[model samples]
Target: MKLKRLQKMSSFLHVVLKILSVSSVVIAIIVFFMKLFNSKNIIMNKLESDTIFYFQTEFFAIPDNQQYIQTEQWILVGVAIFTCILIAWLLWIASLIFKDLSTGFTPFSEIEINRLRKIAGLLLIYALAPQILYSVLHTILIPGYSFTFGLNMSFFFAIIFYCLTEIFRYGALLQKESDETL
Candidate 1:
């Protein structure tokens, strides 16, 4: 029957959607961990170079024999794993937020939704600013990378990412309505 065919189609679509969602989540986590590792490497390298300079020049009084390796490779690895998990959790939370917003999406709303919408808008602006700047400067600087700009780019990405979290929050409201109808 047409009903059974439609059910089969719906089930297939649902599975496909779940696969896409899980893949996106995994990729995002991988990206976060990669960024964490790279950042820690940069920090450790800078510190090592500075320690070497101090030993040679400022601390000529003392022998340049001490190894001042403050950061361990293991620490960076652990941090990367932790950060990736945190990002994944935030993604789940954002979905909840979006679900909530979806429930309140009637064009004519006189409640706190407007305030929340404004808040979301402001956050989007904040998140996009650095990305915009990074693109402009990267185009100009072509070869050289800006440390400050890099940090801003990462921060901006994080913000915009969690912003979608509201999707889950808003969507929950609609889910409730659908459940009640059943």
Candidate 2:
């Protein structure tokens, strides 16, 4: 029965991975086209809604002069997006790990949660190396500190982390049950 459950889980994971890959590609294509068509407009809008100059306008402070989002800042944003996507991808793979650990695709326990947390931390550090390096360099480019990417990516990670935690937490319980049975 356990073997059958694992097999089913493997099949499901295959399907989920395929869906994620297809969707990611489709989104990239759409984003590419949009960027090509409206690159200037997007830059113009960002400049128009430049929140940094809040006092310049009563409602919204548009940068009076054209200014580019700094290269380092751009890299930071790129890193944020990459990190968010990486977390999402890892969580997907985690589903498989949980299933493999279980007779079924069940949740893990507190101990397992801590283990996954460590893994998550490692993954975060790996993903953040580039951002950290660029931020350090950015300090050299800009004499003083500058605005960084907002916590928007954190919002997405929160949801993914919670869901994964819940799933793995259940696996933990089952794990305990199996140990007791043994």
Tell me the whole-model lDDT of each prediction, alpha carbons only. 0.42, 0.51
TM-score for all models, in order of appearance: 0.28, 0.42
Candidate 1 residue-wise lDDT, 1-182, digit = tens? 86555555555554554455466568656655565667544432212221211221122222542332222233333334444444444444344334433443432232334434444544454434433443444334333332221233434554654564466446656766776899
lDDT of model 2, residue 159: 56
lDDT of 2: 0.51
Residue-level error in angstroms, candidate 2, position 141 = 4.1
Off by over 4 Å in 1: 1-71, 101-150, 157-182
Q: What is the lDDT of residue 32 in candidate 1?
A: 53
Residue 68 lDDT in candidate 2: 31
Candidate 2 residue-wise lDDT at 172: 75
Least accurate stretch of 10 residues (summed lDDT) in model 1?
A: 50-59
Model 1 lDDT, residue 166, Cα: 60
* Model 2, position 9: C-alpha lDDT score: 67
The clash count of every prediction, one per candidate, is 26, 11
| Best by the TM-score measure | 2
Native-to-model Cα distance after best TM-score fit, residue 154 in candidate 1, in Å: 2.9
